[model samples]
Target: MREALIVWGGWSGHEPEQCASIIAGMLEEEQFRVHLENSTSAFASPSLSTMSLIVPIYTMSKIEKDEIGNLSSAVRDGVGLAGYHGGMGDAFREAVEYQFMCGGQWVAHPGNIIDYRVNVTRPDDPIMHGIQDFAYHSEQYYMHVDPSNEVLATTTFSGEHAPWIEGVVMPVVWKRRHGTGRVFYSSLGHVAKEFDVPQMRTIFRRGMLWAARD
Candidate 1:
């Protein structure tokens, strides 16, 4: 059976555990055997040799070198790494090495939790194919991004955001390859309501399937 681990929980604002559960259920429907870790140590001590994927649904947590190295080795060996919003990138905010490996992170969204648009870019990518443009009332992330990712979607600041910032593009969805593994990220899902959006659900489903390993 294909196995996956979702290590969620740092701050309740992200509803990390519940959101993790939501995505885990989606994976279960696809026949994946899933495990949910409720806190920072949920997947600690490394040894992801048996797992096919690692999803960290977190925000602003600290990880030790041992913990990071353990998770790092798993990805290097081809374990799919994926998550959305703060859970993946915003996670371990203080850890430089963690941010470096994850690609990018949420810095500040001057829009301050308002509605905005997300336009899918990589229409040819299986994970984003057939997905149309959508809008959501969540924190549109203005981030310090990693140049390494293959951005699949972008959102530009407007309305209140326009007065302060220019037409700098914010990546809504992106993917990067680390070792033999696939790393996927989406800068959405600040609340459960955001998760319920149709395009958001579609994107989440495709990301899960795309992150699964053979």
Candidate 2:
């Protein structure tokens, strides 16, 4: 059976526990032997190397140096990485290394829960196979993104926001390669309710599969 390790910690407002539970259930249904825990557990770092995939469900927080090193080494050895929202983006505020590995950080959510459209950058990718142009009743995440990623999807900012930001903006999902490992991230999933969306569920599952360094 495949192994999936989940580490969740940070802000409680983002509903980290609820989100982590959802992912655990999903992976279990896929027949993967899953290990889930918060950052406080010693096992969260020690046995990480055996995992084929690591999913962080935490938000803005600090990741210890040794734990970071362990996680980094595991990913470098080809463990896939995937997460959404602040858990993947705004996490480890003081740990820039973690931010760097994740590829980007959250900046703003100007159009909060406003109607926005996600544009697919790689519809041909298996992860995006059945997904098409769709609208999310959520925030249009404005991010300080990494230019190296192979952007698989984008969302537009069509709100009366700012003169500095205009035209179509990108949000939703992206993919990148770090060393020998694969990274998949999305700016959605701030709330537990969003996880119930059919399209979002498909995307997250595919991201886990894609980022698992297959």
Candidate 3:
């Protein structure tokens, strides 16, 4: 069985524990040997490299240098990393290395919790296949993303919330590589309940599996 690690902590507003639990349940159902930890220290485990995948549900938290270094090494060595929303994107705000590995960072969410649409930009990608454009009544993330990311989905700002960004198209989902590891991320799942949306759930599951090359 493939081994997966899920570490949750940091901002409670993101409901880290609950988010970790939701993903853990999905991974378990997929036959992954899921290990859940509530502390970032878990990233320091010497055996972290053995993991087939790692999902972090930490937001805006500070991670130690050595701990993050181990994580970076593990991913570069082929351990897949996948995450969603601010939990992964906004995590380690002070750690540029972590942001680079994630391929993006959450900068703002205009019109906090409003109706928006997520367009499927790469429907042919396995992670997005069979999923159509969907509407979300949640925070629409405005992020600073790595240009190298293979964008799979996107959202165009309506300018109703933020005038300057009116026509800006931002990446909602993307996949990239950090050395030998596949990295996947989605600017969704602000709260645990967001996973209840079928499209959101499906995309996330497929994204995680894709990252692990499962």
TM-score of each: 0.94, 0.94, 0.99
Residues 81-173 of candidate 2 have per-residue lDDT tens digits of 999988888887788778778888888888566777778878899888879988888767888888887788888776577546778566568
Q: Cα RMSD (Å) per model?
A: 1.6, 1.7, 0.6
Candidate 1 deviant stretches above 4 angstroms: none
lDDT by residue for model 1 (67-133), tens: 8877877786788888888888798887876776677988887757887888988899888888878
Off by over 4 Å in 2: 40-44
lDDT of 3 by residue, 1-214 (tens): 9999999999999999988888999999999999999899999999999999999999987999999999999999999999999889999999999999999999999899999999999999999989999899889999999999999999999999889999999999999999999999999898999999999999999999999999
Number of residue pairs clashing in candidate 1, backbone atoms closer than 3 angstroms, sequence gap of 3 or more or interchain = 1
The residue pairs found clashing in candidate 1 are 58-87
**How much RMSD separates candidate 1 from the native structure?**
1.6
Number of the predicted model whose TM-score against the real structure is largest: 3
lDDT of each: 0.80, 0.82, 0.95
Instruction: Count the clashes in each prediction.
Output: 1, 2, 0
